[model samples]
Target: MTASSSGALPQPRRFLRLLNFRDSLWLLAPIATLYGIFALIPFALIVRFAFADGGTHFATVLESRILVRVATNTVVISLMTTVVALVLGYILAAGLWRAGPKMQRVMLAFVMLPFWTAVLIKNFAWAALLQDNGLANTILQGLGLTNGPVTLLHNRLAVIIGMVHYVLPYAVFPIYSAMQAIDRKVERAARSLGAGTPSVIWFVILPLTLPGVYSAALLVFVVSVGFFITPVILGSPADMMIANLVNYYVRELVDFNAGAALALMILGAVVPLIVLQQSMGRGGRHGAH
Candidate 1:
């Protein structure tokens, strides 16, 4: 009838409560196991391959020049594509943001239409348009833009164009959403305070949407580093990305260790960039605070 009567039921009751809490772990155990099996295990294996020798021993994996060149090419193409997509997508998103709802809907549909088409179809379409004697050059020649067929496909430019097209939606959607989230009243208030149109945008809208631009740029950059199919169809050997090189190692050379090393290299480069970006963002936020 003392304190035990009200609060403490019994030792068995406490044991049952403990058991209930411990039972919750069972719910997560399966998912954890699956993640370990599918994700962690494969990653561990790839890392091991990266350190192991591709030819004879585990130590030879880091001694490949092809891996070095491929890694460099991947970085260059990814940066170029990210810059192009970010600029074009930012402009388009801005235009869409400024448009009326009807025009916005139409523009959005147009932007999204390409995504609905299959990637292979898009690649072939680019091939048809950009091939030396294809539609684009024919039109150019017809219009006296050039005297001969322009070399468009099987070049770095073609690779960049394809990557931009593939990554545009990724770049635009985030920035557009960020822009849409900005308070119109902030802009109106700035205008009311005698801020010019450009000033209001530069000072208010741009700053507000910077986070989204950063996010979209990183997303596009990461994806571009791994681009393969579009570049293979539209680009020459010089434009080969890390993913394509990795594919060649795995399939053509039948060197799984080298492929894994290349894959790990790509991951290594991207992870640092991401961390740098996040660090900069946090520092900015802290400074602002």
Candidate 2:
């Protein structure tokens, strides 16, 4: 129909159309812009740097030994942290679950209290505790456990401890949330059917909570892989993570190319794990149906 032949649209209708379009754009704009600026741009930069040779290219930052060792350390540390956090968090979550609601809330608050403090502060606290003259060594010496001040700071142990402290809360909350979602009657029915505590846990509770455990493990691992401050504060040269290398390249060496490459490598490593998690989720959904 010709524009003139059609009845004139009401002002409210025209305004509503404009408002709807504006609202749609508004909904999308922040996410789109943020993805491009924060995620996409950095990722593109890192990919470009990864392939570029570090030396002679002046712009290139990828080095064979540096990349290999840093990547290895990063992966190892991340995996270790994930395992430790998952185990510890699971135990804590179990204990909390067993406790009454008031006690559970208290324990949960205690767990979450560390998160409210700054990460830097937490790392520094670790350093203080692990230092040669720190509490650990003093207690050891006081108990005649060692000859002298044990050098605990700036090592893999220190790094792992710091990371566990940082990521344990993340691990705890997800698993706890999953546990809370579980219906009490399900477990009660299993117990009522003569299933022992171990049987009920193994056959009922664990399977249902596998999704949360997997997700928590994945998230904690991913976060640990990109750890910078904890490693720098508590780790030695040998304990240097990929993220530390990235920061050194970007900040200390002022080599964006190498930094980008390292950062991209971090992203590349995490992407597969994320995909695997998603695939598992899809498979689980399909199986449920």
Candidate 3:
């Protein structure tokens, strides 16, 4: 009998490995504990507070004039952060893909350093660099690009800069994962057909990488929307995002109800986007063919 006819099959490289109540349920305990402690409990508390006083807090936030501006600032900054990070991250991912293995390891380390570093530290470092009489201004003055220290910190530009720095790695990895799955033969065939480097990149590589780009954009924007620290350290009062707004309500005003209401609202908007993005990501399979 042929091997194929013997009814034996090779195990898949990866699979679901469905769990049962008796055998495999315990495997989920650690994650279940962590999620329950951090996520589910906090979410439940927020729900309780949001519904207190019959949701008057929602009306309060909606009726406030600052809500319009805060929402606008949040959207604008998040979009700018996403766009800049996506462009720079695409360049970085492409370079990493083209590098030698040893060089790629070094490059990946460099890319992930910021990701490992705390958001506070990164924003503080940017603050130091962007401050008046700081290195950035000194360099600009030395180059005669500016007559004096420019206003770089506590502004929209600074916020975007810090945000882009924080979120760049998130953008890079998705695109890189997508690029890694691309068949090398596709590029080789295009080049063999007398396609130049730019033509090959534009016609072949770019199209293939679009799935990854979409994934990266969703990731970058989601992260950008949740930023509170960068905005506080590197941005102005007018630049506060949704998270900061929640802090303002809970911490400054000591109004947990309003904070919870706003928090739930953010959760409502973001959860749908996340669910949608995850569904889309499953379809892309990280851009694998």
Candidate 4:
């Protein structure tokens, strides 16, 4: 081509470059719109409602006797759920890690079964099983373990059981992923050095999987904190959690401002946990390398 034509091409290229910036904005417009509508707007409204009447709503929430009890229950139940889920998940993950190919598939199915089931259905099923004269109670009585059908339903234990079942899969996957990353040769080397199976697992496997354990604990705890249905169905009124408290304020009392305040309180508690989880994840990745 001629030098004149080559020089002319630069002008069109510059124009295209200018148009690219506008094109990018157009591409991002939908995402920004969605975020504004769903996340930003809701957050703004929550803040407004929470701070209404010079922050009286927050003061009301904080001063309530029910709030104190609910908050305590939320913390206690979440901690219990986290501990139980971690222990059970670790055992299942260890088995999955050591299983043959066929057994691994079976174990995986068992781990994922809860995920496939709806939360409402699972909770309802547990309620039936744990109720007086239900299967569990009948078995206990028939086996001469109890005089009559023991009250298992509508208690803290039942709430914890339901929470643990739901969060178990969350715990298993993280621990199992960590297990998969471990080298089999490391175990063999430990055995060659006269380490017993328990010694090898305790000293080597457990330490290497700490990141996964930490991840699982935080995830399960976070999920358990937001529990509403399980606690309502399985636990008594006295066993209400933070989410239930929020529901009480909104639905029972018809206090939107107070409900928003309670919700913001939950958000305050959860945000730190989420931040900590993210930090641990990053640290784990770095340590792995």
Q: For model 4, what is the alpha-carbon lDDT of residue 164?
A: 92
Order of quality (lDDT): 4, 3, 1, 2
1-289: candidate 2 lDDT, tens digit per residue: 2244255656877766866767757677779888999988977766666666644333344434576788789889889999999999999888887899899889988899778988899999999999999999999999998999988999999999999998888888778866777889989999999999999999988887788788789878877887888888999988888878878888998877767665665677689987876575445422442
Q: List the RMSD of every prediction in angstroms.
A: 6.4, 5.2, 8.2, 5.7
Location of the lowest summed lDDT over 10 successive residues in candidate 4: 1-10
Residues 1-289, model 3: lDDT tens digits:
1244345445532222422323466677789899999999998999999989896989977887787788889899999999999999999999999999999999999999998999999999999999998899999999999997899999999999999999999899888988888899989999999999999999988887888888889888888899998999999998989899999999999999999999888878888778767776678754454
> Any idea what lDDT model 4 has?
0.90
Off by over 4 Å in 2: 1-15, 18-63, 275-289
> Each candidate: what lDDT?
0.82, 0.81, 0.88, 0.90
Segments of candidate 3 deviating more than 4 angstroms: 1-21, 285-289
The 10 consecutive residues of candidate 1 with the worst lDDT sum are 280-289
Candidate number with greatest TM-score: 3
How well does each candidate superpose onto the true structure, as a TM-score?
A: 0.79, 0.81, 0.90, 0.89
User: Using TM-score as the measure, what is the rank order of every candidate, best first?
Assistant: 3, 4, 2, 1
Is 1 or 2 the stronger prediction by lDDT?
Answer: 1
Return the number of clashes found in candidate 2: 2
